[model samples]
Target: MNTPAALTLEAPAEHPFAPFVRILGKGKRGARNLTREEAREAMGMLLEDKVEDTQLGAFLMLLRHKEESAEEMAGFTEAVRERLTAPAIQVDIDWPTYAGKKRHLPWYLLAAKCLAQNGVRIFMHGGGAHTAGRLYSEQLLDALAIPLCRNWQSVNEALDTGNLAFMPLQDWAPHLQRMIDLRNTLGLRSPIHSLARILNPLGARCGLQSIFHPGYQSVHREASSLLGDNSIVIKGDGGEVEINPDTLSHLYGTTAGVGWDEEWPALSARRHVKPASLQPEHLLALWRGEVEDSYPQLALLSTMALALRGLGTPREQAFEQAQRFWDNRDTSI
Candidate 1:
């Protein structure tokens, strides 16, 4: 085991991250979960930037390979929940979106439009290239011509107007945001990539998350089983809200009870519809109105409506509502 390093008063100073680091490096499968206090302390150290890069690097890898326990994930989530920026329209919208990023742009845009149109008010938070999810959202938005929102005011206005609003993750949490650098430097994702997705910037109860990375799916599911009280989770193309047309997308959420019709779309049913494809850049250029709607849009409208419960609308009824929006020409968010 490695000796305990001197910890600064940042993320996990009070916790025994060094021991976990040793255990992880040794290739041990599952050892023990971190206590709530320990997880909170580690997050504090991380936020304060007091943890050494080597130790921090090990910390992320340990979680990646060793996998954090649900209890530990809960503790970490609680700490994040404590340190987030409150939503612009906090008490107004019961369901605020903790947005996920995926390479496909049309799906999230459609989901956001459907959710907003159906009154599942959301505050979509994101950033640039931190992971696959955010990178895709950024790329698509660049092509779509949609405005990139910078602060709470713009997001608040959009949500209030029954449309989606966004805030970049880097702007929300700089310390956590900095972890993305390790990806390019190290040439692989670390645990911070996992935690970043589960972040609750607005501290809202409902979050719409994507499960893209297969390795982290279980980690995410375990975490949700612990801290998820009000959230909507779906299997997206790469973890955003958009379901792949070639695969069935399931809602693996612990929040809101799933109605009969809201169950995950079967692979057979999902693969049944093969919408025509267009070049990514070409589709994006037209998505922004730089061109026109010549590309077939990826569909996630039904999955989205199913996740939010449609404000008490019956599952089937909610689906119908989603269908209409999907078919509508003004479906751009």
Candidate 2:
């Protein structure tokens, strides 16, 4: 009569992605890697909102704590691409910009416009301002009168009319955009940032990307290879697809689904300098020839050269052609 009921605790039900979290979060000796299929399934569950909040947070943190494998990154990206829809227009290049510029104006925007002017159909997609103080491509596109496309239909229409269109990440995939927005709460970037860059929803023949950290270079290279897409991943200034005219750049890429790499020498030997401020007018003026700034010119030409290279132009010839296109650009605005 004096004996109390035996104390007992039951384990919680297993979430679908719980195993994935455990595989990454297990103490070093017990942890293991998830196969590509496993990663694809886990990511599918995440995108479908099948995983619980606790499991989702644990999964994302586990991925952040451990460097993501190429298989993992590629699998997650494959899931995203499968879930998204884009018009079947013939896109020459896939340009994904997630990293906003803090120290420099996004010269890459003008570079994409220049390529579009030369008959290169480009589809640009990106998320905006999570970290503050950085200049996002979306914000700057408005000043240039480039409308943000709402869907594949609008994207197709814009490309048909102008050969270039910018789509926001929120419009393309809201779930992933929600994850990206968590950068503020998580206090660090999760693997979603990397996966978003390689989606290439239109199945474009070529893709261009940039990373802020040097270590992630190989991650992007191998992931792009696994996705079987032609891509160029560079350590661009402020982590954009644009380069700094004063610094040599390492270009990691793939061709016809094969990995290749090269170094883009600096266009100028002078010390690196930052503009006093980012005025959208400066970008417009530069493109219209109202201003003559050597650094910005080199940035645009070199950035476009990389895109042209992805399109199969020889290195030297690509740079030369980019310069020619810039000089011949329509300036009636």
Indicate which candidate wins on TM-score. 2
Misplaced by over 4 Å in model 1 are 1-31, 91-105, 130-135, 142-147, 214-219, 256-262, 267-298, 310-314, 328-333
TM-score of every prediction relative to native: 0.74, 0.95
Model 1 clash tally, residue pairs: 14
Give one digit per residue, the lDDT tens place, for model 2 in 175-248: 89988998988888888888788888898889888877878987888988887888999888888888788998
lDDT of 1 by residue, 1-333 (tens): 999999878664654456655644664465555676778777777777767788887787667666666566667777776776656466212222233333434455545645556556666655456444344455555454334567777767766665556666677677766776677776767656556666656655555566565645555655765664445555666555555655555555554333222454442333443334424665544434465432224355555555545234555676677766655535353
User: Distance from true position, residue 270, model 1, in Å?
Assistant: 8.2
